[model samples]
Each structure stands twice: as C-alpha cells, then as structure tokens.
Target: MNERATLITNEIVEAIRGVLRKNNVTFGEYRAGFMHLVKTQQAGEIPLLTDVFFNSTIVDIENESRKGTRADLQGPYFVPDAPVITDGQIAVEDEHKDKPVMVLRGKVTDLEGNPVAGAEIDIWHSTPDGRYSGIEKHGNMDKKFYRGRVMTSEDGSYEARSITPVPYQIPNKGPTGHLLENIMGGHSWRPAHVHYWVKAPGLRDVINQAYFEGDEWIGNDSCNGGLDEMVIPEVIENGERIMEVDFKLEPAVAKSLQAAE
Candidate 1:
C-alpha cells in the first residue's frame, strides 16, 4: 500500500475503533450502521451524506493555509457551462417573478485585492422553493432557471440575479435524511444561499456560496458549509433583495494575474 494512504487509513481505523470501544458499541448497532451505508450507496447519496457531515471540515482545512475567500461545498445540483447571462437575470422562468429577487454583485480579486479580469463565474442556485434547474426530481431540466455564467469585467467585478433560496431539506426521505433526524437529531435544512464557482487563469479557483443575513440556519446549516465571511446583509429595494459580496482568489501558478487592481 502507499505509505501515506496506509498511515492515514490506520489513524482513521484506530479512531473509529476507539469510538466503538468508548461507546461500547454492540455488533447489532455496527451492522445497522453498515446497512445504512449500503442504503446510502444504493441511493447514490454517498457524496450528499458525506457533504452533510464532513465537507465543511475538508473546506476548513483547505482555507486554513490559504489567503483567499473561503470555499464552500459545490452541492450536487451544479450543471456546468450554463449560458452566459448578460442582463443579470439568472432567474429566468416566470415562476420566479413573484419571489424575493436577489441581486448578487461582487468582485473577483487576488489576495492583494487586485482585480482578476475575464474571470468566469459559473454560478448555480436553487429557486425560492429550493429546486435546482437540472435536478430531475426537482424538475426544470427544460429551463435554466436561476443558473447561468457571468464573467468579471475589466474592473474584475461580476454580477448575477436570482431569487433568495429558502431553507429546504435535502433529499431527506432517503437513508441519509433518516440518519440525520433519528440518529443525529437535526433537521436537514440548508440556508438561503447562492453558489459561485469563480475561475481564472493562473489562480486557484474558489468555490463560493453566499448566504443571506439573518437566515434561520445561518450558523446551523444542515451541510454546515457557509462561513461568516461569506454572509451578505440584505438590502431590499423596490421588492428586490440586493446583496454584495466580493471574492478573493489565491495564486496557484503565479502571484499576479495583472498589475492593475
């Protein structure tokens, strides 16, 4: 086996064994947990389940050594290469007309706060009812509601428009949801948020999710994804909820994308 894999695997195994010993876990309970894993795999929700439990921890570790905006989970519903949106209206369908309009404005910058021009911001988010455009069960594959791509301008600024997504339970009818509620005693509700995958040449891309201020699950998201720095206060005007949150990227291939900020 690979030395690093063996070392890490040994620690993980020992830690799990220690938990079992500490709890005096019975074989029956262990079997049940195994079966739960089987069902989660069968449901094709292993990533979803793991994200709910551990993706945040992984992201925290990644952010610890970086000087850029914190990264968040890239949830299961992302559809790539969405059409380039120009009018700033990401929420396309008429169904979104009555919801709380969310105007997202931001800048893509480097650690030194210099602009990253021509950066592609691939963004996807749920409707006000929490259904993503391409998710089959949620439906709307025929329409690209609340999903699009935007590019940073010469000033390294980008903007998008969508509705404020409400807190919605993940696919909780499955084993993952059941385990969370019955075993962990927690609701499976994510907060109102928007996802932005910021990409530019020579820089490490940032997977960002912007959360609304005063969301019911601000600090208590089921996925535990968004960090305090990612939250934006809401400013309502003429029935639209406007939010501004900038994203800073870390250098990957070099220290500078451009000399100008």
Candidate 2:
C-alpha cells in the first residue's frame, strides 16, 4: 500500500503537531477547533483557511531590478476576451455618475524604452460600491460591466476612463471573517486598485494591479502580500483623478527545439 504517500502524510501531520505543541495547544483544543470549522462549513460559511489556500496559489511576479513596473496578483475575477473599446471607458452607467471619475493614460514599451504598438491591455476592477461585475451580488450574466479591453496606438500609448477605485473588504462574513477579526485579529481589506492584463507580441505577458496612493488600507492590503511597488501616483485634473504610468516588458524566451541527446 502506497507507503511513500503514507510516510509523507505522517510527516505533514507531525509538522502540524510540532506547531501546535509550540503554541501550547493540546489535541483536545485542536479537535474542538476542527469541529467548529466543520460546523461552520456545514452552514455554508466560507472559512479563512479557504482564502489562505486560494491566495497561496496566486503567484507574484517579482521585479528583481526594481525597474519599470512589477506584476501583481491577477485575481480570480478576470474574464478573457472582454469587449474591446478605443475610449477605454469602463464606468459609464448612470449609477456610477456620482463616483469620482478617473483618467488612466500609459505607454507600453520594451526594455529599451521603445513603444510597443498594438499591445492589448485587459482592465477590470471593483465598482465604486465595492462590488465586482459578473459576481453573484452584481448578477451580470451576459453583459460585461466595469471590464473592458483597449489596444495601444501606433506609438504604444493608451488611455482609459474609469471611476476611481475604492478600498474594499474581502468576503468577511463567514469563518474567514471570524478568523480575521477574532483569531488572527487582522483585517480583510484590499487597497483601492485596478487590474491590468497586458499582452504584446515577442514580449512576456504582464498581469498587474495599480493601487491608489492614499488608500487607508494601502499599508494593510490583505491579498496583495505587501507589494508597495504596485502603488501609483495620483493627480487631479479638471475634477477628475488622473494616473499616468508606463509599462516595460521583457523579451520572451523562445521554446527550445533541440532533442535530448
């Protein structure tokens, strides 16, 4: 019987036990906590463990040189092939009229600082009220709202008009919420930010999130894992918040064609 699997399982269990022992937790206490977690799951409550596991799966692309722009979490709400538009306006609904308007202009360039024309940038973000479109709360099934795609011009310049993003809490109503508020004593809020998925030929793809500068949760982003480089400068012009940022992409590595000798 799969002795290797059994050995690994035992090792993992022992590791957990080691941490529990270090924390002065007894088996009874652990068992009681597990039972509470089970009850919470049975009641359709999302546990903090789920979010921990989910966030762990999100990979952060680090910029070792700290040049250009670094990548951030792509998040779980991205929809491929969103409607392409030239205006780059995503927040156009009447309900969003009262929200602060934002103008985002940027240039896509290679490492050498040359503009990369025709690059596609897919952008999406949470609404001003902190609800993302296509989610259960928003109930957007067929149409895509607050999400769109824009292409770079002949000079690799692009602009988008969207509402200013607002800081919002993660799903904090279930076991996850309880753990953040009680057991861990941490908050489950993310800083105001907008997501971007940029793609260009012969260059590596970039998925990033640009954060607002003065967000209250900037120092306490729960999901971004404390990447300060994601924050961008903000300015006000003509009663609109304007953010100007540039992107630099690295050359893509070609697939190896040699056969194993």
Candidate 3:
C-alpha cells in the first residue's frame, strides 16, 4: 500500500480505540469490534446488533412487571413431555412428601400486550428434595417427575401442576463452576426457580427462570444485574399453592431469516 494510505489506515485504527476508550465500552471482544468500527467510521459494514438480538427480548407494558428479584437461567437440565397437569395437582414425587403442592398458571404475551396463542412453554425444576431427577445421586425415576411442558391457548395462557421449588446448590463440577470457584470466588447456589422456555411463531424465544419472592438468594441470582423484576409471588388457595408469572417476548424481527423459515 502507498505510504499515505497506510498512514490513513493507522489513523483510523487509533481513532476507533480512542472513541471506545472515551465511551468506556469495556467487555473484551465487543470493545474491540466497536473500536474498529469507530476508527474506520464505516461501522455499518461491520453489522451492528444489540445484545437483545441474541438473547430474549423483553417488553415493558402493563402487568409486565419482572418477577423474582433473584431470577437466573434454569440451566441445561430438563427433559421433555414431563406430563401436562391441571390446577391444584402434583406431578413429581417429592421425597419430602411434606413440601407444598403448588398450582402455577400464567399467560405468555408479546410486547404489544397481545396474547401469543399456541406458544409452547417447557417447564422443569429440581425435585422436592432439591435434587434434579436422573442425576447420579438420584436414580432414574419414571415418576413423571419435576419436569413438564404446556401449550398456551388462544389467549396465550398456560397452567401447570408442580410443587414449590427449593433453593439448591448449583452443579460445582462443570466449567461454569470452576470459573466461579477459581476466578470469581463465587459459590454455586441459586435461589429456587422454575425453568420456562417459551417459543412461538413470530416471537423471540425466552429461556428464563422465574424465582420465588422474598427468597434469601434473590439478590444473588447468577445472571446478575437484572433483579428486583423477575421474582413472582406464590399464592396459597384452599390448601394448594399457586404461583403466577407472565413472559413478554419481543416481536420477530422483520428481516430475520427465522421469520421467513
């Protein structure tokens, strides 16, 4: 390249880093990309997308309050067809046999306050004894245990039969656990929560965990940063437990290939 062109390129690269430093956009890979774009002043060529693009997109609206201040992701431990149940019913065999039998019901809606009819809600959780079924400590029990799925109706509503979840220690044998213990000095316990992965046509998929209200670990949800807005309350009705929570998903992006598919 010519000397002048090389000089211009260097100047542009420095300019990008300067802008990124000024904005304090610190997060390693993202910081580097943003700096490069800013330096070239042709950021459009780099394809800019927000975090919301990759994760679940949430909406703010009436009755759209976040549940569980201690919300965290449900993790990767659930199986399918866990048995669809009705109100005031228990599906999993709780070893405690004394834990509360909870009835959970709620609706899945979009950002515009419209019901996302026919959405699929996959729900799962640890057993009443605070152990997930099928683990080494727990035998493979075909008791229709603490996992299940339900579909939202025309009104975007769903109901499931389960028990109140209890806080348990996160798996400390995995990479995430190693990072917590070695690098972050963090423990491996998460507040009790129910996993919900909601999906429907034209709606962004939401894989989130709704936490119990007033739990001691609410402030320490592993996801971090977004609390005070994800916890939901449990209501006891005539000897049955009921927890209601709703999910607001973002609309399908207009140009998204998934939308076309």
Candidate 4:
C-alpha cells in the first residue's frame, strides 16, 4: 500500500486494538473482518446504507420516466379534509387572484393502468402571494380554503380545487434552503407545483409535486430533476386556466395488513 493508505490502515488497526484492549467481551480473530465490514458499511453512501438496513429501496428515488427524483421540500402549507368536487369544477378559495382558477382532475391507477379505487389524495400549495400559512402571522388570508383531500371512487378518480400554483422562492430561513441559497448561488427557487401525497392499500405511498409547464423556473427546480411529465401544461377553456394530471403507482405484491393484524 502507498504511504497514506498504510498510515490509514495502521490507524484503523490501532483503533480496533484499543477497542479490544478495553472491552470485557471477547471477539474471535475471524470476527475482525466482520468489524471492518460494519465500519465500511456505516461509512458508505446513503443509498447503500438505507438499502442494507431497511431492505427497502427507499433511496432508489425515480421520477415518472425512471429518472432520479429531485428533492422538493415544501413546508407546512397543507390542510386536511377539504371538499371533494366533481370533474371540470373549479377548486380554489372563494377570494380571487389575478391568475385564473385551475381545475385539477385525474384517476389514480396502478402499474397495469387499472383504476385503483379508494386511493387517498392529499393536495396543498402556497397562496398566490407566495407565502404559506403557519409562516404568515396576522394575515386575513382564507384559512384552509385552498387545501384538501379526497378518495378515489371505484374508477380511481379524484379531484381537487386549487388556484394555479405560483413559482415561489424557498424560505431562506430553513436549513435546507439556507444551505442551498448560500452554496448554489441563486437557484434555490422551486417551480410552480401542487404537492400531493397519494396512498393506496396495495401500492407504495407516493409523495409527489406536479409542476406547471411554461414556468420560468421549471428548468431550475431544486427538486424532482425538472421532469417534463410532472409538468402539466396550462389548459384554457372559455377563458379559464385548467390543469389535469394523472398518477400511476406500482402495485404492492403483498398489501400490508399490519393494521388489522
């Protein structure tokens, strides 16, 4: 080994020797390699560590087209139990904005493209003013008016009424955004996206954000790798903007019944 490698190896050996000298327990010489493996595994990359320990590919994140998943960390702007309306209906707060209201509707299907009935859909986003609640204080903005959830029917269809999401800057106060803003030099802004957490009995929990097309910042989204399929084009009908996007999930081979058991 080179001088540096030899020094590192000696240091590792000395550390292991120190541990052996201090411990009450006895370890066989054959187990020394196992200790090295454990140390190396712990110091390995994040994906390898997660896969080795969790047995789930939690880090094998991929987008709709099997590309790397981008990190889009939206803060606490979500509300629970909003109303469930029908297709083609406007889904937004009573108060209006210069940007038009958009109707988002779609069916939740499994790998085979069959509708996955009873899938839970939760959607939330920041207001047009680019500030999310729980962060804004002493404001008259409608509370919980733009966020909600619904379950897919037998046909796996769900809909939510939300205003057209506006591209917003990441809060520089948060650790993640702060680090990005300081290091990346002015490209920490996320594209316009409505965040959704979709869950079904036989499928994995899907936490995704659907972005809007033609957004100036879509190319620079700090998350989701700026996938094109996740970007829905603004559809206009009779002078109003609309957005429709569908989600396809992989079916779970053995649906977890841990709750019942």
Candidate 5:
C-alpha cells in the first residue's frame, strides 16, 4: 500500500473539505474554483501558484532539523550553466554601466567552521528595473546579464559585482498571474533579493535567496518564503554598496549517519 501517498492525499482532501464546509461554498462557487484550477494547470501555471502559496512551508518543514544554511525554492527564473565569473563582475553588457552596483562577498564553510574551498556558487537575480536577463518574458533581451558562477577561493571567500535588486512583480500576463492578482486579493511584489545556489563535492548543495533588510515587503512576501536568517543589510560605506553573508554546509556523511540512526 502507498501509505504515505494515501495519508497525504487524504489529509489534503480533508483540508479542502473543511474549507468548503467552513466557507459554506455553494456548488457554483466550487465549480468556478475548480475551473480556475483547471485553467491554471492548462496554462502551465500550477507550479507558479504552488510556489507563490505553499513552497515556503515545505522549505521550512524540511529545514527544521537542518544544521547548515536554509534552503529555498529555486523559483521559475533559474537558468543553468551560467558563465564563470573571473573579473568579479556579474553584470555584462554596456547598458549596465549606469545601474547601481552591488558587491556581494561571502564565505562557504562547513558545519564545523572549516572553510570549503572551490565551492561553486551560482547566482542570478532580477535587475533594478525588475527584469531578469536571459528570460524572454522578463525583457526582450535574452543575453546573460547579472548571472554567473563564482568559486570560493582557498579561504572559502568569494565576491561578485552586480546591480542591486528591486521589488519585482510576478508576471501577471498568464492565468496564474491573473489568479494571484485578480482573484487572490494579493499583491505580486517580492522584496529585493539575490538568488544563490552553492555546491561542493561530498556536501549537499543548497539553493537560497537572500533578501535585503528593511524591504517593505519582507514580512509580506508574495510567496511567504522570506526568513530572518536569510536577510542582509544594505551596507553602504564610502559610497559603495557592499554586503557580506556566509553559508555553511553540513557533510553528506552526517546525513547518511542520521538516516542510519
């Protein structure tokens, strides 16, 4: 028997039933809701809807016993195989010369505080104008900008330069976007953040987004996935916006040991 599936499915069914009952939802309303879900699925927006509404809870539950950095959803904008950055610059193209520059420096370490050299950190984020490069839907340009991979040096330190992120609205041109904006009575703005994905051999890879401190949408993320530990301040000293944040990875051996236990 598929015990876990059965248990989860039953629980979900019960939860939906409770909502229906509590709201005294009529058959017409229920049918309309069902059709909306169908439209969302047909429009390939189920993932967006799920991420906007529920992925944060899943991340939180899975991270309850984790000892390293917290994990987060990769979102829908991730593009793999970004070019490696050697000049410490994340923004390419000449147009970004006028954009505000942001410097991100960090160290990747193990749970025991030992530095993990040569860890590959992949990063991508939306532009200050609320567009992500290489995403056609974000901007007409499909060139890679503000996206690259950097490796932690011998001391596990890494740095990259890019433009600061600004709050971006979820693309509301599709069915899912319409549902979130029109029917959900919710805003589609996400706080400014930088997306990070780090990996090292024999260590579990972690993907997380770091939000800027004092963003008005911090507590009201459209996805509800923001964490206090994942927030960083806008460090402006000498007229430069440089910030520092570190990540730690627990050894894979530890996860295996825990499973055995």
Candidate 6:
C-alpha cells in the first residue's frame, strides 16, 4: 500500500484495538461481533461499511466555525435549477400543507455587511414526514415540490413560504441504521432544517443547511451537521411560523491564469 494508505490502516487498527481493550472484549466476543456484521452484510440488510464510515467522518466535522455563517454538510439531496421563484412565493404544494406554515426570509450580504444583490439562493428541505421532494419515496418525478431557487432583490433580500421542517429518523432498515442505533447507541434522527446553496458574483459559493432551534435532534444530529451558529429561532407571526436568517459571503479568491508566452 502507499504511504498514506498504510498510515491510515495502521491508525484504524490501533483505534479498534484501543476500543476492544477499553470495552474488555475477548477474542470470542470480537469474533462473534465480526461474524454478525458479516452475516448482516450477506443478508443485504445493511449499507456498506465505507458509506457508514464516510458518514461518521462527516459527523465528526460539525460545528467548525471560521467566519461568516459556518458551513454544514449538503447532505445528499440537492437538485439543481429548481423552478425560479419570486419574492414571497410559496414553495410547498397544497396537498403537503398539513404542517404549520412557515415564512423564511433573509438577506444575503458580504463579510463587510454589504448586500450581495441578485444572489441566487437554492433552497430545499424534507417534508414534515422527513421525505424529500422529487425522490421516489415521494412519487414526484417530473415536478419539483418543496424546492426552488430565488434571487435576492436589489437590497439582497428574499422570502419564501413553506411548511416547517421537523426531525425524522434516517433510513433504519440498513447497516447505517444498525451502526447508529445498535453499535453506537445513538438516535438516527436529523434535526429539522432547510438546505441552501448560495451563489453570487465575486463571492464564494456556499452550500449549507440551516437548522431549527429547540429541535430534539439539534444537539444530537445523526450526521453531525448541526451547529449553534446555523440554528434559527422560530417565531409566530400572523398564525404562521417565521424564521429570519441572514447569510454573509466571503469574497472569492481570484485564480491566476497561465500566461501565453
């Protein structure tokens, strides 16, 4: 193996050994656990270990705040070019309006507090039932529901109407569920949140999620994507849930082109 691979393998082996020692696991116990994992895989009831490990790594990187809005994982459900929306448009369909209605409004600004007018903010989120739009589970193939793109106006402000997202468990029938629930002894739920992909000229493109405050999973996100800085408090305005959040973008670093001699 190459140097990096060898180092990583050794590190993982050491970590496993440490856990085994700490847990007082004997050879027989270790063998039994290993066999159980193998059997689970053979039965096709679990996801690949690589995917679980990758997701765990993502969880380990949460709450890293540098400047501006701290970034979070994009999860795995972003679709590009959702129908463009004007200010104050509703993104959710009437059929899915069982949950409390919410209005999300925000301003896109630069680090220096200057408005980034005309910035594109692509937003999407899970249904109140925790299923995403345009996915097979939702039976939405052609039309995009609960997802759209809106541009900031001249003052860098935008708004949209939708249902408030709620916490829901991740897919629990697979190996990832097994790892989180059985082995890790942790809940497999993600906190209520909305995803945003913001882009503007001369600014760094940001793909992040805004979480809801007071969510049960906010302190225990399955994917480790929750951070206090990303949390938005909810208010009741005219019988609708209202969340106002502002985004600050950092100027994009210019890349130099190769000069022709």
Which parts of model 4 are misplaced by more than 4 Å? 1-99, 134-143, 173-184, 223-225, 253-261
lDDT of 4 by residue, 178-258 (tens): 335664465456677777777788576666677787888877755423446678877787775666767777644343543
lDDT (Cα, tens digit) per residue for candidate 2, span 113-195? 99999998998888887777776646674336778888999999999888887888877777767777777898788888888
Report how far residue 156 has shifted in candidate 2, in Å. Answer: 1.2
Q: Write the per-residue lDDT of candidate 1 for residues 133-236, one digit (tens) a residue.
A: 87778865644677888988999988787777777788899999998888889899888788888889989888878888888888888888887888887688
Q: Can you write out model 5's per-residue Cα lDDT over 1-261, one digit (the tens) per residue? A: 978889999999999999999999999999999898998898888888888888888888878857899898788788888888999988655776777778889999999989999999999988768888778776655546878999999999999988788898886778777877777877888888889999999887888999888899998888887778888877885666776879999866466666853
lDDT of 5 at 217: 93
Best candidate according to lDDT: 5
Q: What is the TM-score of each predicted model, taking all chains together?
A: 0.92, 0.82, 0.61, 0.60, 0.92, 0.80
User: Candidate 5: where is the Cα deviation over 4 Å?
Assistant: 253-261
User: Between the candidate structures 2 and 3, which one is better when assessed by TM-score?
Assistant: 2
Better of 2 and 3 by lDDT: 2
Off by over 4 Å in 2: 1-15, 36-68, 141-143, 253-261
Q: Tell me how far the alpha carbon of residue 4 in candidate 2 is from the true structure, in angstroms, after superposition.
A: 13
Question: Which window of 10 residues has the lowest lDDT sum in candidate 6?
Answer: 252-261
Model 6 segments more than 4 A misplaced:
1-9, 21-28, 31-65, 137-143, 253-261
Whole-structure CA lDDT of model 5: 0.84
lDDT of residue 198 for candidate 2: 87
CA RMSD (A), model 5: 2.4
lDDT score of residue 6 within candidate 4: 95
